[model samples]
Target: MQLTFDADVEEFRRKFVEFLDEHMPAPGDVTERSKSSAHVPDWARRWQRLMFEHGWLLPGNPPEFGGRNATVLQQYVHLEELSKRRIYHSFNPQGLGIIAASILSFGTDEQKQRWAVPILRAEITAALGMSEPGAGSDLAGLRTRAVRAGAEYVVDGQKVWTSGAHDADVLLTFVRTDPTAPKHRGISVLLIPTDTPGVTRRPFPSVCSPDDLDFNEVYFEGARVPVANRIGPENGGWQVANGSLGHERTLLWLSFADRLEDLLGDFRPRTELDRDAYARLVMDSYALRMLGSGALAAAARGEQDTAALSILKVLGSEASQAASERALDAVGIEGLTHPAVTAPPPPLNIEHFSASWFERYLRSFAGTIAGGTSEIQRNIIAQRVLGLPRS
Candidate 1:
């Protein structure tokens, strides 16, 4: 069966297209150098601010939160259109997509105004401080400690693979608040300013490229975060962490299908094997979109299927990696010759798709690892969906 949106959703798409036509930045407005750098460019910040002012930055949010309170399907369409064009609403993905969402979900009214609004409006950027050296996939095992000290929580630990921390204003840090409690129960989230007296960030290059210095190792040496900055109750950070991750995975799973679609559109198959592979990739992209649509439908009905989300995460990530591999193969050795040391620009950059096939191929591996690893997703699917016992 053909997948399609109803008339109302189509109308929403039409208006959104009009908005884009009027406000979308001209090529060269956001330079390739800026897109590749860790710093958020002035142009990007302005673009995000414009979208927020127009109620298109996040269409599902209320007007005060940079949205028009659009329907869930309309919101999906908004994201799909932007993805099809390779446009990102915010340069800070974790800020807008995950941390801000978590703050809005669990933060008090005052906290929402203090953090979420500025994030949605692009006045400030945030980084997720979830993963550590020992707790990449299994967040429950994170060892970062935050001991309560009067009106402040003294943070002392390290966070690895923290994207954009070097340039971010704040880090939504997860720390062990109660060591005596169970692993998952003792966690808490602290919005620690990057410039705090004891906070230090060291930028690190990813395997994708040496110039890709987006990831950082952040150290907190007796960093004193105000108790008022704590999100959710003390030792109640597990729930906040789950909400944050859920927001991240949900956005990522949908974006993967869009990225695959873009890849398929740009790919030119040469041989019979290439042709077959291209066809399969196209089918996989379609399947992912269908699955995403089903998930959206369920959400609209006030139903949530965590298993379906896991399956989407696995399929979408693997399909993206496979698509990138096939593209590299189609181009043969020449694909391998693309300069690998330079940072890969954002997808909106014209050169991003053309000159960086090798970079894209390397970066595709991150999709599988981020949000949750493929192995972790499979275990979740087996236990939660199939009702299988833990291995």
Candidate 2:
């Protein structure tokens, strides 16, 4: 019932703030470079190396694996602080958030040695290839096939929306390996090297923007991956994928909650958000924070409520939409003209927030669709939370 940071977490925040103040790039540095620079891998690597050296890259990773072995509370503090300052290593999410943690839990020690440290150091980049053009939200319907052949599996299929596939070194992909089993039961996950002979990647225009945040269409024609690369047993990948999604714990998707608080806190009288509007923002923000905290508390104690995750997704998505509307109203027409609205928001650039208001609005709209659609979330609440009949 009592949701608050302990003293240790507060101390960690103070130290983290100091580190950022001293070593973090100046806001303008990102803006200037992004305006003229090409997609330079070295730039991202250099920045990631700096954070890694400071043991700040993945605070939750074990110390031996380049993490601080931070407590859950500490991790929450770090993320919240980073959100407040608008500081985060945007490139590491697919790797650190999903892949590395997965390896830590499911991979052999040898596999961990091969992948974990380099990933934490940001020396390697990875992508998630779970969504196919035909199989998105309905993951079980995936058609990408990986058939066992001697010590390797021959893969053949196409994946769409493979973010960063063009440059990523590897992909954590789910492929169908058994047609006889039921849909969810027939899939398996693999760590595939993109440089394999039969692999081809073609860039696609981002649904959001063309400048950055690009997704790709990746083709696999008899791509051979060692059997050692499989994450879980053949036809048993559903549990692995579901476990990973559950690990996200809803908080990851609700990052908008913190942003909403920031936007609402910065609101002024001239921006056209009425006093009532501001008050509603305050109330909604507080309510979300409490609900999210309770969900986390339940999760940490091993009594996670599926309905809470569904509720958080729905409320959080709606909250983000509401907050975006208010932020645009606060900045008046200026927000509409911001750079993210005009083009891709500059990576790591905090100064060019001009188009970010609108860009964020566009991006956050996906919050409803990404993890699960709002309609799907409602169905989950109806059946799982409300105990309703399917018919």
Candidate 3:
């Protein structure tokens, strides 16, 4: 893969930067809530639509799906520019980036026409219905049942930690199609609409914010999705899931890099000790940039390696967590208070730092646990990357 951009890419970059500068949300409005992975805010949705109309929403998708069929390097550059600006391409990443990519790769032509185009156009939100009450990182152990009844599958199960399930239009769901088969062998993916009868959702608020309870518990009882909605062959959901996870891990790395950059810009030191801490934080971020570039380079190769993604996941999440922790310590008591609460005044840009990062430490920790936990990443790295034996 080429490390340097050609003249065409350089031109694309120049225009993209200008586009972002003209369209980015005013500084104060830029926050995690606006970029919620599960919930698409009205403003953010509008932004997505604007990009779609201009053929910039899903640049890697085909022109039939409103993308320009951009090259891999162009796609990579797009992600890098968005991260540099801390701008998310779509609020419903579960729908567009991860699940849609899976559908494009594995879905039947009809299924792709039905699902992929709408997803790329940002016309619907979808939640991944992985991570059952008991399955989680050990997804093959999932017990969610989908009994084939004629032309449809009657799904009955519960999905926990289903981010944005309440707001989603559909679920790219996994279920056991042949329970008597080996654990991984029976699994299948079904695209179930959220409004199907017998589907229910309950929100679970986070420590990060009361208004943003992005996680939910979703229940399915005899909810039927058409057999045609299945992405791959029946009892072949694991392959689809692996493809989805690769896309997800790539996004995780990019977002972590973006957040770390933002944290550095927002860091403010009031003491000599704080200066020492900030220095370490900057150095760690610099190292992470190099590590992150390696991951991007891997993606640019046009084929993903799960082992490589596992390595990047471990490094990126830890680097993000470390930065968040340092931000809290840098501000001392001010970090404990809400930015809206009454508090002592900070000097100069310190106020900006305190306000932006007051609750960020908690958010970052929660984010690390999502997608795949740090512990899970370590296991992947040890077993798959290092060829370590399972004791």
RMSD of 3: 4.6
Please give, for residues 1-391, the per-residue lDDT of candidate 3 as tens digits. 4557788877877777887777766545533243235566655666777677666777777766656778766777887886554456787877887888898889888888788777766677888899988888889989889999999899999999888888888889999999998998899999988999989988788776666667889998988878988889999998888888766676466666666777777667778987887788777777677776676676666666777777667777777778778777767776777452234322111112334455777667766676788888888889987899978
Q: What TM-score do all the candidates reach, one by one?
A: 0.93, 0.85, 0.87
Go through the candidates in order and give each one's C-alpha lDDT.
Answer: 0.85, 0.73, 0.75
Across residues 207-285, which tens digit of lDDT does each residue of candidate 2 receive? 4555764578899999999999988677878887877676554466458586666567655546344666677777888
lDDT of 3 at 313: 73
The TM-score between candidate 2 and the true structure equals 0.85
List runs of model 3 lying over 4 Å from the truth. Answer: 1-4, 18-38, 41-43, 271-273, 301-303, 338-358
- Best-fitting candidate, measured by TM-score? 1
Please give the TM-score that candidate 3 achieves against the real structure: 0.87
> Candidate 1: which stretches are off by over 4 Å?
32-38, 339-351
Residue 117 error, candidate 1, Å: 1.3
Q: What's the true lDDT of residue 202 in model 3?
A: 88
Error of 2 at 137 (Å): 0.4
RMSD of 1: 2.7
